[model samples]
Target: MSLLERLNSDMKQAMKNKEKDKLTTIRMVKASLQNEAIKLGTKELSEETELTILSREVKQRKESLHEFDKAGRQDLVDKLRAELAIVELYLPKQLSEEELSEIVKETISEVGAKSKADMGKVMAAIMPKVKGKADGSLVNKFVQQHLS
Candidate 1:
């Protein structure tokens, strides 16, 4: 089934099961997806676009978690962690670090990226291949390490 359908089903299930946290997170995701659709003047988004939106939500949650951790707000951090877990359930299985590293290495060579100056070129070529499978920051770190 499509991501939207799956989300709708899960939302209903969450409501029935009284899973407040999961329900809230799913609602937030649905709202985000709907907003993006409205902004683009479309009724629906493609699977790839949906994945991108989900990834963005996960990234935002992780950043917030980091800030909360730094502030020693355990309650907020725990909440964000739970939300992040729910959001991640919809994402594709993430690539292992070693797998991501290999892909970055291959892309660097494919693009003949030798110096830091070529980071952009290498990233542009590699991101499409990795997309939802790997975090962009992690891929970037690998690229930087390999290039330097």
Candidate 2:
């Protein structure tokens, strides 16, 4: 089933179970997806597009979590943590550091990236391969380590 189908199924379950937080998150995600499809003038989104939107949602929550952590807002931080957890449930399984390292090494060799100067080239080549599976910052860290 597609992401939308999964979300709809889960949404109905959440409503029946009285899971307010989960139901809200599901609705928000569904709305964003529909909005994106409208914005792009499409009837539906491709899996790639869906993954891209989901990744953006995850990234946004992470950024917010970081900010709340620094501000020492425990209440907000806890809420964001919960929301982040729910959002992450839809993302692809994350890549381990070792696995990411291997890909970075392979990509570096393939692109013939000699040093930091080729950071852009390495990132452009690898991001598509990794996409939502790996965090961009983690990928950048690996690329920097391998290149330098």
Identify the candidate with maximal TM-score. Answer: 2
Query: What value does the lDDT take at residue 29 in candidate 2?
Result: 91
Measured against the true structure, the TM-scores of the candidates, in listed sequence, are 0.97, 0.98
Clashing pairs in 2: none
**Residue 78 displacement (Å), model 1:** 0.3
What lDDT score goes with residue 67 in model 2?
A: 97
Error of 2 at 123 (Å): 0.2
Off by over 4 Å in 2: none
After superposition, the stretches of candidate 1 with alpha carbons farther than 4 Å from their true spots are none
Please, what are the lDDT tens digits per residue for candidate 1 over residues 1-148?
A: 9888889999999999999999999999999999999999999899889989999999999999999999999999999999999999999999999899889889988999899999999999999898788888998899999999
Worst 10 residues of 2 by lDDT: 79-88
Looking at model 1, the pairs that clash are: none
- The lDDT of each candidate is 0.93, 0.94
Query: lDDT score, residue 33, model 2?
Result: 97
Q: Evaluated with lDDT, which candidate comes out highest?
A: 2
